[model samples]
Target: MNETLAHEDLPDGLGLRLKVDVTRPLTDLTAAVNALCDQVAERRATTVVVLELAATPVDFREWPGDVGIQAVNRWERAIRRLEKQAAVTVAVARGTCGGPALDLLLAADFRIGAPGLQLILPVNDGHFWPGMTLYRLVQHLGVARARRIVLWGADLTLDKAAELGLVDQVSEDLEEALHTAAVLTGRISDRETAVRRQLLLEAVSSEYEDALGVHLAACDRELRRLRRTRDASPQNLVGQAAS
Candidate 1:
């Protein structure tokens, strides 16, 4: 995974650029994802992962469920870490998405879907493949809210995805949507983006009383950081003695 990424560099400040094509083997896709995480951490910037899903059924080189559990676990963990990394993650979904594709989209900080985007969790042997994708759906839209999607699997049209808040933007011009997402990512500290993302993820299940202390601590940390920034300013430190 440490090998140099074959995609675009950090020249324009949009961190690593990577592609997720389900037609490829799971190993290849997972390796690419892990590499993206590493590069984003090093650059401390935003990353946009473009998902390439076939509009029709894919004859997967390697079925996601056919892979060993360890591999699946590793990929899922990478996505989880990616979600909490200091770098912002933006996902672009163009066609129908499901399985690993849907998992990646859910993990992203910002998701952009094409106007005709549809989401599904592929069924194998008459049962929906049980993966962390289901867990993520539950996390995003609690168990009750995600009943149909979890119980069996439901196709989510672009409009439905937007209504469910799964996608941040839908556009005919995916490139422009990505540009808009990149601009939005710049409005916040890369580190703070991860912090706030973690807070939001936890906010879903955490009770107010239990979450209060954690929220207060985050506020205090921010205040302390602000003070440190102020004290380190050139104007404020002009007369300070070298210690």
Candidate 2:
């Protein structure tokens, strides 16, 4: 999978650029995802990013449920790790984002879709697909909305996606949107961003009081780190010091 596609470091601070032919077979989807995760870790990129609908669906004559489950598990683990480690994960989308693609897109902190982008949640194909998508949606956007999308298997346009909070914004040009994301990514402090992300997840999963405690502790740690950085800027190694 790594050898099949070329990855370019965008000169304009675009992080990593992945080019996937959406019309091709995705038998290597799992491997591609793993490679991307490795890249994210190696680069220490504040925003581990992706441009969506890069690969086309692989049409298997007979679906292998076991392989599908394994792919789902690997994807879920990778997404959780990347989301936690990266300061501001971003997804720039064009065309249709569905199935495993949608899974990856939803994992991003900010999703910017193009004018013709479409979001498809297809869990009702009269077959057993993993329930993680529904769970994540429920966790992000409440149960009712999750049910509406999962149980009914609704497909949404870019406008509806923005309205439903699925995508952050829809841009006429994808490159412009990516450039905008690059600027936004540059402005955020990694430690504070990571802490807020964790706190937000905790607030979603835990009680309010517990969430408050975690947030306050995160704030304290951030403040102390800032003070240390201010006091000792010239002493630390390059790219190893506090951001």
Tell me the TM-score of each prediction against the true structure: 0.84, 0.80
Clashes of each: 0, 3
lDDT of 1 by residue, 73-124 (tens): 8887877877777766778887778767777789887788887888876566
Superposed model 2: Cα runs more than 4 Å off: 2-6, 21-27, 44-48, 55-68, 189-191, 229-243
lDDT (tens digit, per residue) of candidate 2 on 112-194: 88877887663434542445666678878887787777666667888888998989978888777877776777567265787
Q: What CA RMSD would you report for each candidate?
A: 3.7, 5.4
Candidate that scores best on TM-score: 1
Residue 155 in candidate 2, Cα distance off native in Å: 1.4
Per-candidate local distance difference test: 0.72, 0.65
lDDT of 1: 0.72
Worst 10 residues of 1 by lDDT: 1-10
